[model samples]
Target: MNKVELVYRELLFQALEKNNFLLTQKELSNLLSMSLSTVNLSLKPLRRMNAIKVNPMNLKTINPRKVLLYWASVRNLNKDIAYQTRVDVSISEIEKNIPANCIFGAYSAYKFRFKEVPADYSEVYVYADSLDEIKKRFPSKSGQPNLFVILKDVNMGRYGKITSLAQTFVDIWNLGEWYSSDFIKALEMRINGILE
Candidate 1:
């Protein structure tokens, strides 16, 4: 109804689709570049309207809340048919197998991993929210996210992994004149040093 509400909805939907499952208020705060208080305050109305769902209904210092919010656009669709469902499982399962998270510190890192979506993140390209949850889902995860690896053995291959040539294409596509960004160069230097 209000402009601010619309923005919150957009951000929440992005998180739902991006994170594969649950995103904490802290992550949302960082990603949106908004204060935690502001994020929490704004979420009140969204929660009241049933636009979002908070799991556990408990709070803590490090991992206070888990938002299981859904986007309005696909509320009527079956859970299996929704795009966000796949991501929820894919990310968790992947992390479970890896038993750790990837360092998605920048756009290049994310592009090198996940294909480019029309989302914009300022820092830390990709990370997992829950290792245990997704790992549990991995075995039966046959949703839209398409984890890509170990598809036959587990719940994967939502969008699927890009081939090496395809990776080159997506990498180049996401990184146009990355040389111009001092940040990109710094990151490349760091990663390259590790390789060498």
Candidate 2:
């Protein structure tokens, strides 16, 4: 992901996952290792969307749903896919065998977040730094990939093993799989529960 997307991810993680709405550009820049200009540029969209209220000292997310939806709508999920290869193993097997540094996302994230799923998922999404290692571990075939390894960013593991809720929601939404809507619905309900 680019610096702009990293900024968004950081902001979303702070607000939704960390329960922190007070954030400064300087703090974001330092945390994300991005320039202040880039962080400001990324916030412009959130400002325009009225998703956040910018104050002299800090910015606060006024409408997290708007911010979440905006990021989800614009996130280039395909571009982040560093490796895609069909694996014959079950989703559980993939989940159990993922690299230690790799973070589970999408369906795997939903399962981790909520402890259950409405339906079985066929694909496993993960963020990993070593694409070659993943490729070596899971060789590709002719069919659609059952495993998608997304390129990992430096700021990805702030929330720990699972992807942040906002990140997971956006990734699953971008998947466009038959089961995505179900996951979305479940995620929305979970988000609402949290926001309340």
Candidate 3:
């Protein structure tokens, strides 16, 4: 993820997920290990969109759903995929075997967040620092990749084992798979349910 995308993820994770909307640029810089200027630059578009309001000491999102939709529109999921390979195993088995550093995303993320899914999904997406490590763990290959290892950004670790709701939505929306819309519909309801 680029710095701006990272900023968006942080906003969603902190504000929407954690219910902490009082964020200062300095705090963001400190937490993200980014320069003050970069954080400022990242917030500019959000300000223009009215998704966030910039104050003297802090910034607050006015419409998180707008911010999320904006991110979904811009996110390039394919560019983030570091590695893709087929693993001959059940999806649960693949989930269980992934390295600790990897954060489950997409369908797996939905399952983690909601504890259920509308239907079964074959793919297991994860964000990891090193694709080589994942490859080593699941060495055996097959026809098509049921496993997608996305390159992890520096700031992504804060969300822990599963991708944040915003991250999961964006990733699944970008997938363009047959079942992606189903996941997106379910996720939208879940997100709305939380925000309400």
Candidate 3 minimal-lDDT segment of 10 residues: 135-144
Question: On a 0 to 100 scale, what is the lDDT of residue 90 in model 2?
Answer: 84
* Candidate 1 structure quality by residue, lDDT tens digits, 60-106: 22111122222222122122221122334333344334323322223
Poorest lDDT segment (10 consecutive residues) of candidate 2: 1-10
TM-score per candidate: 0.25, 0.96, 0.94
The lDDT for every candidate, in the order shown, is 0.36, 0.88, 0.88
Candidate 1 local Cα displacement, residue 61, angstroms: 21
- Among these predictions, the greatest TM-score belongs to 2
Which candidate would rank higher by lDDT, 2 or 3?
A: 3
Highest-lDDT candidate: 3
Candidate 1 or 3, higher lDDT?
3
Clashing pairs in 2: none
Clash number by candidate, in order: 12, 0, 0
lDDT of 3 by residue, 12-90 (tens): 8886789987789999999999999999998888899899999998899778898899899989999978788888889
Model 2 Cα shift for residue 161 (angstroms): 1.5
